[model samples]
Target chain A: MRELSITTEACDTGGCPVRVVRVSGYIDAHSFPRFEREILTLVNQGNNRLLLDLRNATYICSTALGLLMSVFRQVRHNAGDLVIAGMSEKIANIFNLLGISKLIQAFPDEEEALRCLAAAEAS
Target chain B: MTTRRRDLALMVPGEAEYLCLVRDLVTTVARKAGFPDCRIGEIEIAVDEACANIIEHAYGRRPPGEPHVGKPQAIAVRLALFPDRIEVRIRDRGRCFPPEMASSLDIAEFAASGRRRGIGSYIIRSFVDEVHHSYRPGRGNELTLVKYLAKGVPGG
Candidate 1:
């Protein structure tokens, strides 16, 4: 089994102010602590705009989904936004079925999510 | 005519950290039970959620200031693969899950509530054909999940 990890990089898209968080491998209760710490560190660092890349992530338990929601809310609280991209169809449908899709914006890829991050911010 | 049946049992300490191993075994069993790849994914997720609840609710996450009771409890799962349905039973002795919690949940209400919890039961019921839980005084709780095979699918 692969280990879970959260790594980051900062990129500016026409002054859009975006931070990319790439999550991979299995993320469950055991690994959620590191995941939460890294994301909150960014939020507390004032990097509000975020693009989450989950193409490589294999499994995301409910705890992880909740963590994502927490981060999304925190970002919005600071007048910023977050969009996720590259989820497997099955994973995306889980989020959709739970209605998380209604609150969080998701895209097929990072590029599309980036293109619409600002637009989604209006919601 | 006679058909063959297969059953497997696993017992692990009631804790969240061991779910990764449980998911792997469940996926393997589901795959061998003739479930499609997509269905296997659903089974894996549903079982993970079920076990997570057992760890969190049954065993109770060591309260902030309280010490654990000597050692954590144990949860056991039994998988029975038949020609008609794949049945899984998870048994725990720590605490009994409310019978109603396994019932269908209102997605809209859950969303509006802004809560991250309570979605596991829904997922388990959604992914499988049927879910049933039984409890006995001080005996234990058993949560059974069943996924029916498609018509014409061979199990024997």
Candidate 2:
């Protein structure tokens, strides 16, 4: 089994706190539940603005992708946002093929995503 | 690639922990079959999605993160390499799935509908060139996915 690690951090951007959840490894059916629980815990705690750092994540199955879409809706409904960064072409291709990228904004890296989210939160 | 055919087969317990092993096997086979890096990635995801579906739905396992109290069943995976394409056949004794329902839906609408599942079929359909499903009363369900090495392969 591929190990999936989810570590979270919060950056106080003066307007809203941008929570960064960094995940590494395969987020397949076996691991998505933990991933879901971690993210939902943050959301339920009022940490809505999120940056999903998938830079180290090698692969994400359909189940996990579907969960992200659902989470995106939930975050938006709560007046918060969920964005992703550091996806390889392989991962990005899957997102594009499924149209998930169309709904969830993805940046090339964490720095760019943080900047964009910070700007949005400030404005 | 040559006209000569090559084949590979694997049977693993229907558990989420073995999903990565399936992906790794597919990747190794695909690379050896001469698929490019990008196409190889697509094939890996397609096969992974299919096997995941079998483990979760066919074997009656609970959703992710939940334990399955029942004993795990066997998932048989067969790969055939042809001159122009590669075909993966996954077999399980679990319930049958409607092949007609494997269309790539509008992701935005599906997501907005608040549905969590039904994306596995979408991924399998989008990544592979063709999907064929058949089930027998006692022979179990077989789902075959084909991917062409190039864009214009006949029937691909």
Candidate 3:
């Protein structure tokens, strides 16, 4: 099965570590483990502040949202934070309907989300 | 016996591995039936979720990453194309699920729960126009999703 492509770049801005994971393609029940494993691995590596970029994701199923929640809970449990950015229109609609756009830390793009995470870390 | 008519049918092992195949089949059938792109995406997702639920709950399989024991089950998905709508029935010869699981989704509560487990069934119920579930005792379980096409839409 073709899984979501996960490219994680670790950035340290003024002593704050933010792991930006850019995911492309579909995120569903079958493919969510790839996304989940990446985030869990990053969290294990101490890159707690996270920015999951889904702008290029073709689709995000509700099960994938659960995967995101697992990552969110993991980051929060470790006293770190997580945010998402670059949601495609379809993904954004699903997020909006599920209240994720309102409940989670979200931004229009990676840059904005990185800035927010870094700023929060600095505070 | 649940007697009915079906236009297309496809079956896959009740494992998460074959969800894409089911989704692709749904997409092709929905496209041939003249569903709009957006609506087609919704149908694809809803069907995917239905199949997923069948794989998990019906077959009694654990979530991904957990060690699965014993043999995998099989899930059958059928489609019925009609003039005003499309109906999809997903069947599994595994354990039966509660008929009440097809209840309406509470978006607010679901989000408040951190968007956890119930999202799959919720999405299946939300995106599709109608959803229904039936249990055949020791036989199996069947979940159906329906999407109504707009009037005068081509291929209807």
lDDT, residue B19, model 3: 83
For candidate 2, write residues B1-156 as lDDT tens digits.
367489999988888888888888888888887887678888998889888888767766666555667666889999999888888999998887544445547888987998888887766776788888898877778999888887512113
Query: Across residues A24-110, which tens digit of lDDT does each residue of candidate 3 receive?
Result: 877777777776777677878887688888878876777677767766766777888789888766566666655666657778988
For every model in order, the fraction of real contacts preserved is: 0.32, 0.61, 0.37
In model 3, which residue pairs have backbone atoms overlapping below 3 Å? A55-A86
Q: Please compute DockQ, using alpha carbons, for every candidate against the native two-chain complex.
A: 0.39, 0.57, 0.33
- B10-128, model 1: which lDDT tens digit per residue? 99878766788888888888888787766677778878888888877877775433545787688898988888777888999967775344456554455445566766666776777
lDDT of 2 by residue, A1-123 (tens): 348999999887656678999999988878778988998899889888989999999888877888888889999998889999999888887787777889999999888888888888778
In model 2, the clashing pairs are none
Please, what are the lDDT tens digits per residue for candidate 3 over residues B57-117?
A: 6676677776557666788988998767788988888776753343455555665466567
Superposition error at B95 for model 1 (Å): 2.3
Poorly placed runs, candidate 2 (over 4 Å)? B62-71, B152-156
The order of the candidates by DockQ, greatest first, is 2, 1, 3
Q: Rank the candidates by lDDT, best first.
A: 2, 1, 3
lDDT of each: 0.77, 0.83, 0.74
Query: Which candidate tops DockQ?
Result: 2
Q: How accurate is candidate 3 locally (lDDT)?
A: 0.74
C-alpha RMSD (angstroms) for model 3? 5.1
